[model samples]
Target: MTFRIGSGYDVHALVHDVSRKLILGGVTVPFDKVLRGHSDADVLVHSVCDAILGAAGLGDIGRHFPDSDPLYKDISSLILLKRCANILNEAGYAIENIDTTVFAQAPKLEPYKDEMSHKIASTIEISPESVNVKATTTEGLGFEGRGEGIAAHAVVLIRKISKKSG
Candidate 1:
């Protein structure tokens, strides 16, 4: 059996719009500013997707879901995460576990960590115990701390599925 580990990081600027929900790992985190991106811009999910692809020896998110593609216009990032899992499964890789952290100074996320974990696990067709979502602040030091943007980091472990168990 072969195992691989990969990590990904993502950041998006917060826009002035209040209409868009601040989604992280498919869970809505209420905030006045929404992330700016071609997609729904769930930074946590995006980071996880990248991590999965990385572990699978696939290219990054931009290679799979380009911003220039209209097919992904304003699409939910959870959907993208699902696709990533499918890709890995088709490549004979199984998800071992995923850990992630969201960097934000506002709209405290301690309460939503469990829900985020559940959402991410469901999206990838994995057990909730295999997913861990955490949140932190930069102590008002950077763009995330200053409330200008949000960021997330994710690490994933994937193992090649043995033919007997696959």
Candidate 2:
């Protein structure tokens, strides 16, 4: 059996756009501000996608979903995650585990961790237990602490499945 590990991190600036809701891990969290980006800006999902792609040696998210593309405008990161899973499947890789951390200063995320895990697991077609999502604050230390942006980090482990001897 072969295993690969990949780590990813992403951050998006917070904007005062009430029209745009704050989305993380495919769940909308109640917040006054939202992250600004080309896509829906679900930071957690973006990081997770990057981690999965990295594990498969497929480069980063930008390589697959370039921001320059008009088709991905305002696209959902969850969709990107699903596409990533398909990419992994094509490469004969299966998700073993995914661990992630979200950084923010407001709108406490503790309540949404479980849902995030389940959503990610569902998207990847893996057991919910294989996904773990954690939230933390910077203690007023960095951009996330200053409430200027939201960030997430993800580390994923993937296993190459063996083909049956027909």
Candidate 3:
């Protein structure tokens, strides 16, 4: 019954690129600007990955999947999330629940919250009820409010299910 908790935050600049799509929590949102990053740059998913890894005593996402790696270039963040899930399972940690928040200035995200939660939960092999996704605006107070970038924060609760075997 060992319980651990971790929190993570991530931000990425927004850029106008017709070739790039705005992806958040594994769901593509209709927006004129896309997040700029080496991978798909889904800030929400990245935050969740970091939270899960931290809770499991694993390193952050950058340590697991570096932006310098060609294999991750333009790769889907969902794949990275699945890998994090596998890492947690291998370490005998079971996810209890995850809560996340996204900050943005435009392209209202209310319509896509459910899909985001479901997709993230599915990727982690957990129930959708265990994952919660929320979005908010900075009220013109920061980079997100200025529409310059998007940021996300995530918190995860996990418990040790079994001891790792040597």
Candidate 3 Cα outliers beyond 4 Å, as residue runs? none
Model 1: per-residue Cα lDDT over 72-118, one tens digit each: 99899999999999888888899999999999998699999999999
Q: How much lDDT does candidate 2 score?
A: 0.93
By TM-score, highest first, what's the ranking? Answer: 3, 2, 1
Provide the global lDDT of candidate 3 against the true structure.
Answer: 0.96
lDDT of 3 at 150: 96
TM-score of each: 0.95, 0.96, 0.99
Error of 1 at 102 (Å): 0.7
Cα lDDT for residue 112, candidate 2: 93
Rank all candidate structures by their lDDT, best first, as comma-separated numbers.
3, 2, 1
RMSD of 1: 2.3
Q: Give Cα-based local distance difference scores for all models.
A: 0.91, 0.93, 0.96
For all candidates, the clash counts are 0, 0, 0
Model 2 residue pairs with clashes: none
